[model samples]
Target: MEVDHRIRVSDGDGETTAGQGGVVGVFFARCWLRLRSVLVGLWCWVAGFARKVGRIAREDPRRVAHSLKVGLALTLVSVFYYVTPLFKGFGVSTLWAVLTVVVVMEYTVGGTLSKGLNRAFATLVAGFIAVGAHQVANRCGAQGEPILLAIFVFLLASAATFSRFIPEIKARYDYGVTIFILTFSLVAVSSYRVEELIQLAHQRFSTIVIGVLTCLCTTIFVFPVWAGEDLHKLTAGNLDKLAQFLQGIGI
Candidate 1:
């Protein structure tokens, strides 16, 4: 005789063997998926820090003080990213935007307040374009093939237009490129939600502001690194090596 597995509660039947098997399978699958997601996130975080460390090691000839400075500065600023709610909601976009501004300002703009302002402006502009485009696309019912085509066209146009006008940009085209890629990538990743896109636009700007301020504070408080140092150091090293080579030749 088969067991009557159904338990009739107030509304309907509660559980049968089939339902139990499905629920159990779903539970295991969810657990597996969550574990995988956590593992991947951890891996990426570790890889990012490792890459930062490696780059600093390779670039800093005065490896001791500069590396320590870089590490402490990054750590201090990154505290906001990991510990604050402002950056928490933006997810990967926050990290990408912050890293873009930080790296560019560090190398090109002397990481000053002006560069922070530039980053904030660029980020807001990018968010505006992304959110506005998404809203327009949604209003027009552009999805599937139409959406893809529109995105491709927009990308090509953005590149062409910016390439022509980028000469006047103070920080050059790096900020423009960062905005372009970030806008397109974020739009692509979070597609077709007009309301959500609006929310994202707001969140992106807020997080970017937080990130830019973090960088500004970091640069101001820490031993600020500059790109001219590399040029000066390289020139000095070349001259020293040349003098040694001349002495050896004379010997």
Candidate 2:
């Protein structure tokens, strides 16, 4: 009887150990499968991205050239941060030029030119107006300054918003008007907090102008792309095709 009991206990221990081993094996297999799937997904994503870029380059090699131009422009502008002498006195304001390069750089030379001019003019106009508003607010004393600034912001913002509804302005100067509102609000609201508001405005505006100039030069001198020329060519090609079709149809 004692021998039988010992054999049964040994059998139970072996079964329990085998069950635990099976569970561990299954868990590792599942983990390996998940890991493999993740690796395959990453590989697929990289391959897909490469194919798309290659397709784009093949479709229009000009796009790749334009991309290079943008990179070169950004590199040129970034030099402002690297060279101490070149960017002396500008300090952190140099970043504004970088931001300008990012936002103002367009696919076409004409678009870049238009945006750059609009930004410059808008910043200039808004700075002057903000300074004027600040001066008026100051006369009202410290307590009244914030109140007046808020009111100015509200009124100018409202007017700018309303101007967007006008068809003429919407078509021609919408971007400029929007930028003007932003610049004015920023300069006007911060005037009370900043003692040397003029200097601050000057730094920001100067940096932005530098960035705009960088974009303009890079776009024009380095394989210029013109939307107008492309449009003209496309229209001419379509007309030619239409004429050919009409002749073939005996029209």
Candidate 3:
């Protein structure tokens, strides 16, 4: 009887050990599969990115060159602000020139010109309106000025927001309208210090102009990419491809 009991206890211990081993094996197998999947996904992403770079190098070197030119232009703007004594007084606001360049620059000269002009015109209009509004509000005395300003801001904001949806305005002058709204808000809201508003507007306008000119010069002078040319090429290529396909199908 004693020998049988000892045998049974040993059998139970062996079964438990085997069960734990099986569970551990399964866990490790699942972990390995997950790790392998992750590695494969990472490899695929790297390969795709490498292929894209190669394609760009082979087929569209101009795009890469244009990007480099943009970088050079931005660098020049930064250097001008940092090194020039005339811009030193503007301090951190000098960065606005860089911002404007980034915003206005496009893949093509026409697009850049369109956006630059829009931004400048919009800002000019908004600034003038803000100045006029400020003058009018001031005459109403301290008591009524805040209330009147609030009403004015509300009305302008609402109008600007709604105007964005107009098809004609949105097509060409959308950027301009958006800029007007933004500039209006900034200048109008900051009207408490009316004395400094004009200087601020001047500084911003000059910075924007500098950015626009820089973008235009670089885009035109340095390996220019014309939208019209690109469009022509694309249309021609598509037609050629279609003709080839039709020929292949005996059509």
| Winning candidate number (TM-score) | 2
Candidate 1 lDDT (Cα, 0 to 1)? 0.62
**CA RMSD of each candidate after superposition:** 16.7, 4.9, 5.1
lDDT per residue for candidate 2 within 89-167, as digits (tens), equals 6777899899888888999999999989988999899999999999999999999999999999999999999999999
The whole-model lDDT of each prediction reads: 0.62, 0.90, 0.83
- Whole-model lDDT, model 3: 0.83
Which residue pairs clash in candidate 2? none
Two-way TM-score contest, 1 vs 3, winner: 3
Relative to the true structure, candidate 2 reaches a TM of 0.85
Q: Total backbone clashes of model 2?
A: 0
Estimate the TM-score for candidate 1.
0.50
* Clash totals in order: 0, 0, 0
Candidate 3 residue lDDT tens string, 92-196: 557877998888888888998899999989988998898778888889998877777777788998998899899999999999998898888888878865668
Candidate 1: regions farther than 4 A off: 1-64, 81-94, 97-102, 105-115, 142-171, 193-195, 225-251
The predicted structure with the larger lDDT, 1 or 2, is: 2
Cα-based TM-score, every candidate: 0.50, 0.85, 0.78
Predicted candidate 1 versus true structure: per-residue lDDT over 1-251, tens digit per residue: 89865443343565334546666777999999999999999999999999998898777644554445446556655665686674566665566545644453453326455556656776676666665555555566544535753675467557745765555652465655556566655664475543466666776677666666666665556566666886798899999999999999995
Ranking by lDDT: 2, 3, 1
